[model samples]
Every structure is written in structure tokens, then in C-alpha cells.
Target: MIIIKQYVSIFEPMKKIVVLLIFLAPVLSAQNYTIGNWYDFKKGAISLTFDDGHPSHYNTAIPEMNTRGLVGTFYVNFLWNNSWAIEANDVGHEIANHTKSHDSLSYLSVGELHDEVTAFNQKLENDLGFPIRTFCYPYGNGGESDSVMFYIQDTVAQTHLAARSIAKATDDEHYKYDFALSERDYYQIRTVHMRDSMRSYHEDFRKVISTGGYMTYMFHTIGTPGGWDNMEVDHFTDVLDDLLLIKDTVWIATFRDAICYHRERKTANLTTVYAPFENGNNWVLNLTDSLRDDWFNHPLSIKLEKPTEVVTILSAKQGGIELEYTIVNDSIVFNAIPDNGHIIFDILNCEIPIVDLTVLDETIICTPDSVRLEVNYDSAYSYSWFKDSVKLEADSNVFFAKDSGNYFSEVKLNGCPINTASVGVSISGVCGVPNANFESDVTRQFKDEVITFTSSSTNLQGTETYYWDFGEGSSIEPGYYGPGPMEVSYSTPGEKDVKLTVTGSVSFTDTIKNKIVEIDDFNSCGIYKEDFNGPDFKFWHWCTCKYGYNYTMEFVNKALRLNLTDSIYGEWDNFKLFFYEDSVMKPFDFSDDLYKPVLRVRAKASDTCRASFSLLDTNWVSTAGMKMNQIGYIDLTTKYQEFELDFSNLFFYEWENKVVDSTAVWGIS
Candidate 1:
């Protein structure tokens, strides 16, 4: 016995049985069947055909088809001649006929139809030396004065060949004949046409093939339309490429070849059972049987009840044969012919759970001294710890890590791996100190001037140890040991780098360049130059007193008697005065205030270049026998413009006048 089963879902369980018969002959290969006969086979088949002898049949269609090693039938008309018809003789391509004028066959009488088809056939045979066996209705019509059905039957009988028309096939047995033949009651064939660019056609092709059934694709012209019924060449090539990729799983052949192959290969001893389970249903079962051979033997029926059910049907070839039953599920049971060959069903609702991990707290900057890691999990039963790739012994919810590395954790549920998460840890330490210097021209002079040195450092987190090297071969003040302004004396002139080393928790050092100091000692004098005749000489005296030089003289000013006193020195010590009024000095008594004199004193010496001083007091007396002396001198001559006096070292002094009564040597000089 042979049996077959067809299920809606491939997931359903199926079974088959094979029994060897006595005196069976072994076949080596597939048997060849006659051209027009039907064949029965384990799997269904279909053929793809094309029509309309458009120019693309050669240029666009053939080359694309050569890529996939596919060939199709092309029905032509006389209008597509040497000027328009594809050169069919050049390639092993078929060319059939539409009418010579492409007139609707339904409008023509049977005799005229015969003349139209035969004339085109004769033209093709004379040109290509081949008999045309196929014909397509122009405008898809097949009738003339008679009904299309009667016309198709008559045409087939007259031509001693088959004919094909356009119709779709369905599983309904009532429409089987209409779907099977070109005309209602004739042996004519009917087929479906598929355009290359139609998405619906590809989807239908996939659906039919996936159902383990027949699928046919039909095409017309293979290029841009010059008339109706046209398709692009590339579109045709794309379809062929798609089909070739699945050629192993699909049967691709000519229309006539497929019809004949399916008819003769049909099996009577085999049956198929289809069982489609409802949505969310837990179980599905299928059973099949093959009485002829194991290759065709398969389970054809599937049973599905909540707990258990025994399903049976009449054997396709025999009756009253009981198959065995078995308990495969807790409540579900199945039956099979052999005890051990029964189908088993399983309905498991298993799903993988999702796990998510997150950090609850914001991350903190990692340092060499401290680090903390915090994390949280959702839908996670447990976790396995890891650092880098090495697994840690403890699998805790959170981990505190101080070392620098990649930290990861694997989640688990009931000891099964789920997902993993990771974080990176980094470490850092404290910064260090920097240095200072200075330049100057003084080395060792009191000069009453002061210079200072500053200290600096980096990463001084707290109080730092400041070591100041002043380059003076002396240590800093006992109490001063940090960054501050401090004075040091350089009695000589030079350059120096003050080094400051700041050591806190972190140690650092820095140096500052060219701390300079300078000192000098020089003296200058001032004198007055007068342009007077040389031989005629006059005596002039210059003096610098505390206030200035004083000489008493009488003067009359407009009915008033005025007494004038000469003071030579200015308020500052480094100045000199010149007495150049009337070009000469008038003789006057030194002991008595009798000589009125003007004195000029120029600047004598500078006090440290950056120093100044105010006059304290001044007095004037004769240069004779008065024992009066100036701390510095000023000469009245052309070369000595002014007298320069260094009173910076001078202290306070007093002088008095002395005279002999008789001759008066202290008289005017």
C-alpha cells in the first residue's frame, strides 16, 4: 500500500510506509513518457511559456536567458517579419504564430482561421526549416462564427496538435476541467500569464512553489512596448535569475513537458493529508502512507485534541487496515501503522527572558587612592562577575573596584547564561612643583636699597615646603619657608637663579633666572665760566653753606633804602651757584656785612641716582682767618662750570669769624 500526507505547516510531524511486492523489477533511471500523455509523480510540476515574436525575443530575451540556461516558446505573427520579427533561426528558440494580421481569431471563420495560421507556419518553416507546433490567439481570442469552445475543439482535431488558452487553476475540483483545457470540453490546455515586472506574479509564484504545487509564468515581448503586451528585457532576465537560484527546489520546464510529466508520473497508491493548526495551538500531527515504495510512502493525516484522539480514514488503496496508536504527550496520543514508527508531538511555550543592567549613581573620577563601582539590574536572577575576561569568585549586585581594568558581569537565571554588561576603571595621582630666578647689577653697597625674591611651585594642595636659594650664599630667614616676598642684599652686581623646591604630599622644584643688583661710587664738580678781558683780573669767591652764601650790600630802590643778602646754595646738597652779576665780584668786608654779592651754585653730586635731600641750615663768613671751611668746593672758571659737593657723607658743623683790631687782615679781599 502507498499513502501521502500534505500539511499546511512543515513543522507538523509526518510519517510514511513502504512495502516491497514480489517479482518487482528494479528501474535504473526516470522513464521517458510520450509527448502528449499525462504522468503521475510524487511532486507537482509547472511550465513557463512566452508569446509574441517581438524584436526583444532575440536581442533582449535570449542573451539574458542564456545566463540561466532557460528557453521558452514564442508565438509570432506575419507582421513580425524580417523587418520586425526576432531572428529565431540564429538561436535554438521556438517561434509559433498569432494570425498574419493579428486579427481576433473569434471573428474569423474556421476555414479563414486555418488559412491564417497555416500561412504563418509555412513562412516560418521555409525560413527556419522547422515545423511550428504552438499557436496564440491574437488579442487572446479563439472563436469565429462558432463558439470559442467549438472552435478550439475543431482546431485541435484539424491540426492533430494541442492548443493552450489563458485561465487560472484552483484546488476546486468543479473548475478542474475549465482550468485543465483550453476549451470547456476539449483536450486544449489552459495556462496563466505572468508579467516580469509584476510583484503579484512573483509572490504568487513563491506561494505556489512553497505549497509544493505547480507554478507557471508566461511572458510576451521581452523589451519596451512597440504595441500592447510588452515587457522589458532586464525585467525578464531578473525573473529568470530568481527562478534559477531556486531551481533545485522548483521544477522548470516547457508547458507541454510539465503537463505530460505530471500526468504520467501521477501515483494512485499514494495519498496526502493536510492539517493546519490554529494560532497559539500547542500541537500538530500528520500521517501518510505509501503502498508501492518507501520513496512515496508518507503520513497523510494529523490529529490534535487537547489530551488524546484516535483518527482513522479509509486507506486510499485498501480497507479495514488498523494502524497502531501510541501516547507521545501527557494528554495527546497518535496512531501509526508500525508500533515504533508512530508520530510524536510536542507543544512547548518557551521564550527567552530579557535582562537589563544600569548604574544607579553617577560615576566619580577614579584616583590612585580611591574608587567605587555601583550598578543595578532588571529581570536578572543572578550575575557572574568578571574583570577583563577572568571570572571573579563572587557574583554580587554591585562591586567596588580599585584597580584599573575592564569590569564586566554575566547575568543568569536558574544557572543559565542570559546577557552581559561592562564598565571601565581608571586611576590617577597628584601633581608636582615648579621653580624661579632674577637679574641685577648691585653686589655690596649699603645704598639703602632693597631687592626681593619670590617662590613658586605646582600641585601645592596644602602647605608646601618652600626652599629659597637667593644665590647670596645665605639661608632664608628662620621663620620664612614658603612662597612670599623677602629682601636680600647683593653688595656686588651680577645675575642669579633663585631655586624654590616645594615639597608637600607631592614633591616639585623650580628655578627663577637673573636676580640682579648694582652699586657705584663717583664724584663731580661745577664751575662758572665768565667772558671778561684776560689781563684785567677780578677776585670771585664761591661757597656752599647750609642755607647758602650770604653777603651784605646796600641798595636804593625808588626812595626806599633796601638791604640785599647773597645766598649761594639751593635747598639740595648736590647743587652749586654761580655769581656772575655785573661780570665781577665787588670787594666787601668779610667781618662786616658791607659787600652785596650774588652767588650761583650748580649741582655737585647725585645721591645714589634715586635719592634726594632738603637743606637744613646755611651761614656766610670771610674766607680769611675765620677758620670757616666748606665740606666741598666750587671754582669760578670757564672749565669748571659748577662746583659738585658730596655732602652725602657730611654731618653738621659750625664756624665763627676772628679779626685783629689794628690792621684788619680780614678786610675785603
Candidate 2:
């Protein structure tokens, strides 16, 4: 933010410079104007002042401002129990009076007025050891007959510099009166603000600047509101931010400074003197402005044209003290005070050139053959190379590598180092990575099938580890790279993923035929491992082909136990169960699908009798009467053990020719 010089000649109403291509021409005013006799040439001004010192003002608001190096003026209602008002003053904050007892001076008796308004100012001033000039009427009321205003100006607390009113006194005359320091300056200095409208400070500030006058914003008890007339800390700080933005052009100061500046400018005197410099040497100048140093200590800004052919300034001094200066296009600008008397500068020869520079480092790459890195740049620069962050001994644009790592190149221009990266390049190298391919005997078949596997790995060279993952709690530990066929089997399976992996520096994995063989684990054959509860023989009606031996069929112990009692077995006693679904007879068939038909049964019998489950067609009778279909012979035994008979390979012959309908229309017999 630029310092706003309130020099009273704030407006150059008639004089302004209008430049036309390649030429600047100043229009003379016939009269030089200053903005309100100010310190810096600022056109507008503002002050962040709070009223009725609330604890939030001290505890919350001030710290936030202090962090940002800002300060506020607090008008305390001494009668209120707000204990933080004194702390506000202790921190260099301006504390003014909001009146004792906070009585409404608009209607208060003369005696009550003095007690509420006058007494509060003196009491606060005495306690804080700082004279209080700025005042805020309690509840923003100036007594019934101008008592508060009269008191501030005359007898109550003569130490007071200025008092503010919140009546909005928006009348043009009042604004000009306050801004122009007219008769009603103290009582009628109208504020351009609204309650709780801190959010609008940015635009509101523009209004103050447009008016080009002394505009004072009035508030009551900032921080958490003790009443409806208070403001939030965030809301207050928002206004502060708006003030800082124009700190360069707008004069932001305490209410007291506002009154002091006008007084100081009236009495202050200034003069400028310069010491002659040798030809082609330095030039020096001193300026002094005398006012009461303690009260008018605001820094003044000075701008001077750069001397002919002066390249730069080496140093600046004021009263033997070094100061910072900015040399802007044929102009030297600096801030100083009259108290220091004058400023001196040593001119020097210096030329700082401007150039666009960028640096880069190429990332490392891992490949197989060879790696080469190179750079592209202008020849005007001196080149230096680096490898892996270490400055290389060579100064070249290209760096050839026997090993893999990061590399970069730097160029020096006018003794300044500028670095950049190499062009990305890489080659091939070795690290174990193999194609895990394998071959299997068959896929999609019955369960418990042993699948023979043959490894077909490619580019395999390393301390390799081999593994076989048979998708179901089944795994094989890795073996060193070598070996041919590995035998594996699947039991009780569906589609089991038999995956093979060969791991090393770079691991590899693959599955035989991209999918494991799907096995129909007896589930599709209905209930082979079931009791009579399943939908097998329980739902099929049973009858003897020709009853010869005494037979009993019953469900016992959850098992379908067919008993043949004390008799010799004969082929005529064969029992067959008919397949039925809702009384619609359908033949058992698996020839349409892939699973080869198989008959498995658990039986118990003696040497004289044997039981077996087989399939026989109703149309099986031929010239050979009572011919059997596909019948599986069972072994006679007293103990029970299940045995499987693959009827898919079964066939029958009649008259020197094998029956071709072996898989046609079969019932459980």
C-alpha cells in the first residue's frame, strides 16, 4: 500500500500531465495543490476506530491486527464491567472515552451529563497515563444541548483532540464541515459507515476517496456485541484489510493523528538544499520539515529525477544513518523525516541485464542394451556436465554412460550458473523376466482327473522360483528353474484355475490355456453320494422285470436299502426304477452334453447274492429274449464300499452285431 500524502493539495483540479507517444508534457496548474497539508501526498484518509471497549476488542480483535501490524482506537464505556479496555491501551492501542455510566446525553441533565461524559474521559486518561482526545458519545448521543460536543471542545477534558458522532450527519454541509475543518468540525464530522456492514468496506472506502475529504467511520463496541450496535471481530478485520490495500494512497491513522496533522501542517516549515558533485560523480541533497517532532512524526515522501548518466545508487544516508531507496525510471524515491535534516546518496556505475534461464535433470531409466544422454542449447553459454547430482569433470553437451543413473548439464553465462537436463535415452539389459506358459493334456472333464502339465517358459535365466497354484487351498512351493513335466490333480472341482508362476528379479505368471479345465464333480449326475432323501430313486417308481427271488425294498437309516432275502440271485429278478417328472416319463440322457455317463453304487451282499445299478431301455427286447442293456456287475460282499462303473464304454451285441443305441433311453436298473 502506498502512503497517502494528505497535503491539502490532494486534488490537482486543473493541472495534470498528458503524454503522447514518446513524449511527456506537464500541464501547469498556474497553482500547485497539496492534499490537506499532509505528510505523504495521499488524496483520501481513513481510521479504524472502535467504540465502547469490549473485551473482544482487546482479546480477539487487537491480536489479529497486531499480527498484521495494524492498530485500532477503542472508546471505552468506563462504567461498563468490560475489564479489557485497559489492556487495549497497554498494547499501544488508542483508548478513548465512551462516557461513564453510558448515560444518554441526548436527554441527560447538565450535572448527569458531566458525570457520564466528562468524568469518564478524565478518569480513563488518569488511569491509563495517556491523555484521551477522541470521544464516542454513549449510545452515540451528544447531550440534549450539545453538552458532549461542548465538553470535548471546551472544559471537560481539554486533552481531547477530536470527538466523533454516529448521527450519520450525512448532510453535504456537515461532510464538508468535517472534511474542511469548518466550525462544526468536532460535533459534525459525519461518518460514512453503517452498523454491521463491515463486509462492504472495500466499496465503502471508494466513497470516502471519491469525496476527497476527511471521512471518519464510527462504530460502537467491536468484538462480540454487548448490544445490537456491536460488530464481530471478523467483520471488523475485513474493514481493516480494505484500509491496508490503499495504505499507499489513503492516509490511515488514529483519530488523534487526524486532528494533529492539520495542526502540524499549519506550523511546520520545510526547506531543501543540495551539495554540488564533481563531474561524472555522485550527487547529494538534504530536506528538512520542522513541526513538533513528538506529535508530527509521520514520515514524508520525496521523489527526485535521476541525475544524467547515473547508472545506479550505491547507498543512501540521512543524519549519518543508512536508508533504503528505490530508483524508478529516471527518478529516485525515498522516505525520510525532517528530524533527520537531510539525505545523501553515493551514485555508482552498475548494469544489471535481464535473461530467461531454466535448469533440468534427466531421470534415470532401466533398459537392456545401452544408455546415452544428450543436451541441446545455444553456443553462447559455457557448458559443464554432471552425473547423479555430482559435478562432472567434463564440460560437454553429451554424456555417454557405461552404467545407469541420472545425468544433467549446466551452462555458465556471465559467471552465473544455469543448469538443465539431458535428452532422455535408454537401452536394454538383463533381469529375470520369463513368459510363464504351459501345456495341459485336456480341459473340461470329470472330477478327480489327473492333469499332466509341461512347462513352456521363455527367456528364463536367473535364480528362478517356480510355483503352481491350484485354485482351492492347493499350492506347490517353488523349485529352481529346470525340470519338465509336473503332475497335478483336481478333486471335487468345478473350474479350477491352475496357475503357474516363475519369480525372480522380475516376476512372471501365467495359466495353462488361459483357463483351467472345468470338471463336473458328480453334481450334474444327480445324487451319487446321497441317501433316499435325494431326487434319485426316491422319485422313480420301482418294479421287478420278472420276480423270481424274494425281495424287499425299503428306506432304512436314511438309506435306500434293497434287500434280497435267503434266495439265490437270478437274472429274472432284476429290479428297474422308472424315471418320472410330474408323471411324464423321460429317459435319462447325458450324450447331448460332455460328461461321459458313469454308474456308481454302494452295495452290501453275500456270495450267493449281488446287487448292482445299471440302465436298461424299455425297447431293449430283441430276438434274444430278456436281453440286458448296459448292466454293471457288482462284487458280492457283506461290507459296503462304493464302486464306479463307467457305462459310457458299455455295449451289447445280438446276432454278431453290437447294439449302437447303447446311450439311448436308459432307466436305473
Candidate 3:
């Protein structure tokens, strides 16, 4: 509120007052509403919403909406992953909650309802930083009783501002924007189901437009045709085309925006005061509303008519914040979430124009099948086509678009340039890639085998992006947006679900499937560690010293167990198991010459055991080789654990005549 104390002197000139009016005239969007007239007094509003968090909804529906410069709401669920919904939220679309488990709420108690409704709201808010106001009913099955429905709204989903349910029957032909609301009417709002045939949706939309009502649409699975509520991308785009045509007349908003605007306008008041000050006139715009701050804080759009020839505004400010405004014909339109506070501004000196652009997207991929250019339907405006900045000879309404070039249409109204919308037409890239398809060369390969994958999909147009996952824990070309076969290998033996995900820019669709494939692990050599599967130590040797102690070694159940029983402890109470420890019997040397550690031997004992795995090799410091011993200690009285001894930690030693240690070579333990 601006309070002015004026003391105008009789000597003040009229020229000074006229100059003062010129200063304050430019900053005004000078129009006020007779309260509760929403969106230039449009008949109704419409919001495009999608559910189930499908991949195509983000990759397909969002890009299609962005082409028309419209945003939507996604009732996000953990269909694939939370990250996908978070990505859609980051793209400036509303992300709403749809519960953790998409289950029927037929017999859920109050506590279970919280788990389904309130808890889901908190989950989405925590993950995406998106406040959950709108929710979609899981399967829309709360039709049991009116009292139960009221219980859900008043108690269970009390946190949500409103909830949407599937009302295909009631909303198909008899849909209306209910201006009147009970306590639970908003929470139990119904939405028209959108599927393959959008004729019903379009009809209801027209009905809403003709009758001054609202049409709320719900869709799922954009490219997956014939699936549950399958709305194909092309069929969906057909509706978006007509919506863009009527974008100016209709208020295309998210459900939250529409509901908030309805509540805010019912109590909003815009007041302007004009009075004489000491030297100039004071024009202050005071905005006040009765909505609470917690629930209703969204900005309301204000359309202000240009008061004078000072129409070209340089700046407009309120509460010290520079307001976002636009020029449409002779009006300076801006927005403000009112708070009974006064805003002060002055006329800005800048030129602006009013362009009624109806084109959704200019860039078109030229196909042998079809293409068309948007000519101005209004004969009042002159339209001309251009290719690469060169004017075409054709000035007709229907210009068939062909060839590849940067094309644009210049629209002139009343002999003045209004818009110059351009379209970049290209003859490259795929057009209709609805599903991702791929194949691998072989299902099962050895550990060292390199598996190959290739694409075999229909409706592939131009350039493509490819992702390949070899299910044995190897991935190739991640986040790669192109076409190529992927090759990778696995180390262990297991079955694999090799998946390939490919998405095309022309049509955003993905194929996520597991191609049957298997892999084999590395074949083990019985030198250091093995499940013993041969004759028991035949080629080997064992020595047992008798001092009231005896030892017996045998292969039992694919395992090697050396049992010992000692009645008395003596100096010779020892047993050594060796692999032919003689001069001619040299230990096995790894052919790859690769240094490997961790000797694993599964063993069980009858008594407390102490044994040493001795290796006599020539790779030691001496030419004749030194004896390197790795100790194994276990007392597996009931159970056995695999003993893993790392040979890399062995001490390096060389001997001269088995006496003095010389220069240390590579240790063999």
C-alpha cells in the first residue's frame, strides 16, 4: 500500500504533470478481471497426464510434448526404476505419487491406506524434491461404498490435495468441470481414459470446449501398442497437433496448475489506485487474496492493457522483484502470486510485437511417404516459403515439402513482419522405431569367447543409439546413442540375460529383453587347488613316521582328506604329502608363466593338524632350486574350510651348494 501526502503548489505548471504521467504509463499491463474469470475467460481447461512410469512416457511422450511447447504431469511409480521418474521430473514435468505397491485398496485398513497413500507421497517428495499434491488411484477400485471412499479422502490420503481416478464411463461423453466441491469431491476426481483410439478423448475435449468445462486425460505406455491402455506415439501426437492449434484459446495446464488457479482466483482481488501526489500521479497495483500460504502460493497470470503510446515497456517490478511479462498485441501481460502488497513500476521504452504462432515444430524428417508445411489459414496474413534463405516462387497455401534444407515461413500481418518460424528438414535418421530388437551370435561361449550382438528391428529410420549388456557382468557402449554390435567376455560360468536397449531420436522406444545366453568358467588345473576327481595320490608320494602316530590320505566325496591319530606326541609325529618329490620329478610349471597366488585346498582332519605344502623348484635363487614351504594349519574336527595360501608373500631365496644363500631369483612357493 502506497500512502501519499500531496501539497501541490498553485504555481505548479500543467506541463510537469503531463511529463509525470508519461513516466508512469509504460510499465502497466492495464487490465483487471471481474473476479473468477480464469485464463482470458476460456470455456474450460485441459491437462495431459501419464501414469505407471513407463520408459516410453519419458523418452516418447515428453519429447512429443516439448515439440509443441507443452508440459504434462507424470504420476510416477517404480515401474522400471526411480531414476527414470527423477529424470522426467528434471525435465520440468510434474512428478506425482502413485504408491509403492500398485495393489487393490478394496479391504485396506486406515494404516494400510497410509502405506499406500501418504507414505508414497513422502517417497516421491524425498526422491525428486517434488511436492506431492496430485495422486492417481491404483486401479481406481474404491467403488465399494461411499463411506469407505470418504474415509480414504478424509483420513488416508489426507495429505494429497486431490486424487484422480479412472472414470472412463462417466468422463467419456458426460464430463464437466465441477465448479462446486464437497470435502471429498476434489480427492475423488475422475479422469477420462486415453487409449489407442483418441476419438472419445477428442470428443470429450470438444464437449468441454463447447460447454465451457474441463477434460482431464490419463495415458500410459506410449509406443507399446496393444498393451494395457496402450496409446501409440503417433495416435497421441495426432491429439497434440490439434491441441497446439487451439493453444491460444484453451488453457492447457497441468492438473495442479489448473486446480491451484481455480482456488486462487475465487478469492483473488486486483486493485489499482490513481491519485495526485506532490508533483506526479501515483499508480499502484495492490494484489490481495484469501488463500493460505501453505496450500495456495502459485502465481496468477495478469493481463494488463497498454495505457498509452508508452506501450513499449522497459521494465516492470513488484516487491523489488523484476516480473516476467509478455507483450501480446497492445497488452503487457505479467504474473503475480498476490499478497495484498503494492507493486510500483514505471513505463519502459522498448519495442514489442504480437505474433500468433500456430506451428508446433518446424523441423521435419522428409520421408517418401509424407510431409507438409504449415501455411497461415488467415488470409489476412501473407505467407512465403524459403529454402536456405532463398525465396521460393510458390506463394500458395499448400506447399508440398520435399528435399533437405533449412526451411522457414515468414508471416506478415498488415504489411508488418510478425513471425519467422523455421523448420530444419533433413533426409537422414530413422523415422518410426517403436520397439528395440537385437540378437546375439551364440548363446553359450567359453570363458575367453567374445560375444557379438546385432540389431534386427523393423521401422528403423536414420541414425540409432545402441546399448549392449553381456549378462555375465560385462557391459559395452553404455549411454551410446548409435548403431553397432557389442562384443564382450566373461570370466565365470553362468547363464546370462543379455539385453540390448536401443532408442531412436525420431521415435523414442526401447527394447529391454533377455536373450538366452550362457558362459563357462575357467577350467581349473589340479596343480594348486582342485576338487580331487582322480586316483588318490598315485603319481605322488607320502611319508609317515611311526612313533605311535599313523596317517592315512584318501579322496572322499570329491575332496582330499588326510586323517591322523596320535596316542603320544614325539619328534617323528609328522606326515608329508608330495607330488613325486624326486630329482627327475620336477613340479608342474605354469605354461602361461603368469604369477598366480592363493592356493586353495579343501581338507578335513581327525586330529589337530599341522602340514606344509613344499615346492622344490629351479626358479629360486639357486640353479638347483631351493625348497620353499607354505604352512597349512587346520583342526577341522567337524567341518573343513578351504585353505588359501598366497604364494606372492613367500620369501625369495637362492643357494650355493645348498649352504650359502646367493642372489634371490623369482620365488616358487
Error of 1 at 27 (Å): 18
How many clashes would you count in candidate 1? Answer: 89
The TM-score values for the models, in the order shown, are 0.31, 0.39, 0.45
Model 3 steric clash total: 13
- Sorting all predicted structures by TM-score, with the top scorer first, yields 3, 2, 1
In candidate 3, which residue ranges exceed 4 Å CA deviation? 1-32, 40-43, 142-145, 169-180, 272-282, 304-314, 324-332, 347-669
Clashes within 3 Å, all models in order: 89, 37, 13
Q: Write the per-residue lDDT of candidate 2 for residues 588-652, one digit (tens) a residue.
A: 44332234444444434444445444555333446555445545445445454556555444443
Q: Please give the range of 10 consecutive residues that has the lowest summed lDDT in model 1.
A: 660-669
lDDT tens per residue, model 3, 555-624: 3323333222221332223334433223243333322113333344433232444433332323354456
Segments in model 1 whose C-alpha atoms lie over 4 Å from true places? 1-42, 79-92, 143-148, 168-188, 210-215, 225-227, 260-669
